[model samples]
Target: MIEIDSRAFGNKIKNIRNSKHFSLRQVSNQSKDETGVAISPSYWSLVERGKRNIPKPQTLKRIAKGLRVDESDVFRMAGLEAPTEATNLTRITSSEMVSVPIIGEIACGEPITAIENVSGHMLLPNNLVKGGDYFILKCIGKSMEPTIMNDSNVLVRAQPDVENGQIAAVLLDDDTTATLKRIKKTKNSVILMPDNPDFEPIVLNEDKPGRIIGVVKMEMKMF
Candidate 1:
């Protein structure tokens, strides 16, 4: 929701980009890992020359990271209250970036990042993540629709458990299959509830238990 003086922002971005000898194409590719958003070089060239403005803070953050420049420095050029906003959003000050693997269904029988399971990788801001194993899961099926669109990706923090009523990835079929659901633990069984009312929830009991793959941290469209 931040407004930008596009001309001034463009000059600053151009100067820094030139100093670092980065091509618009290179920056575009580098930025994909940072935000998982595809950047078009043709459009970005216009952005660098004062002809266009960055549409949102997220794109600005990606370009800043791709330039290896501290975002606060760039934010100031746009007259933004970087510190207050970044803190509130858990955005980090450090320029460090972390690459998180994008994996398919995770089952207890297979390694979390098994070569076959890993489809790709996404770069995340270091400060945005806390200590723990992290991975990106591709959303599938319509059970989680409306809340999570099919084919989108969810950032997951690998963990053994999640609180009741929280959305989590669960491994069933004796840890051979995985599914996404909102869990509710009853007195003697666990219910895997879906956001879509059309789909029925699955109930698990002591005889057939479900293992938690991880709780979802954020849902990403990757557009």
Candidate 2:
């Protein structure tokens, strides 16, 4: 049993949970229903935030089952090797998938209304999208490169706000245009930071007219 850093392990679990688009309540409910284990959301939150060590093996198995990921993978993420039998655990599959519309292209430069046109649709795994109204936008500039490249399709969850340091699709100048950028907030202004250092950050007054259209949840690269 390799020792795992509680904080690092917790962050890994948090990232996986978010990528799966699962809420703490959902995980807890599902785990209880499926595995007969009742892990509270508060305890899970503590586990995810590094306030607690990894749970016991049985509890970890229940958690893995609840998250719909391989038990072995969960153990591995915690810096422990799974028993040989655990490696053979079956994969989890959801009965339904979510369909997200691929909207028009969004400018990583001057900002364009990317949702004005519908290009096509994408079928995403139910676990990947959960329950939000999601849309896809094609990237049109290199300013967000190395993370969101030009021509890549980005999945955005329809929301009006995002936490600081999260990427969002922002509607600017009276909803006429939109851009994809990482959001940072100061007391006086909202800063749109580009991933590529070559691009300068765009700062708007806190009382600016722009609104957050949605948060960039995930990106799909175009081959």
Report the number of the highest-lDDT candidate: 1
Which residue pairs of candidate 1 clash?
none
lDDT of candidate 1 at residue 69, scale 0 to 100:
79
Q: Candidate 2: misplaced stretches above 4 Å?
A: 1-95, 105-116, 206-208
lDDT of 1 by residue, 1-223 (tens): 3566788788888898899887786676556543357467876788777787654666677777657677777777666756555464654444677888898655457777777678788788876567888888887898976456577788888898899988898788857577889989889988999977799999988888878889987676464
Candidate 1, position 85, lDDT: 52
Clashing pairs in 2: 112-178
The most accurate candidate by TM-score is 1
Clash totals, every prediction: 0, 1
| Residues 1-223, model 2: lDDT tens digits | 7889989988888888899887887676445423135678899899999998878777777678558688788888777777575564555554566667777644444333344456677776676677777888777787776456676678888898899989999877656567899999989888999987799988878566678879987666343
Which stretches of candidate 1 lie above 4 Å from their native place? Answer: 1-95, 105-108
TM-score of each: 0.56, 0.51
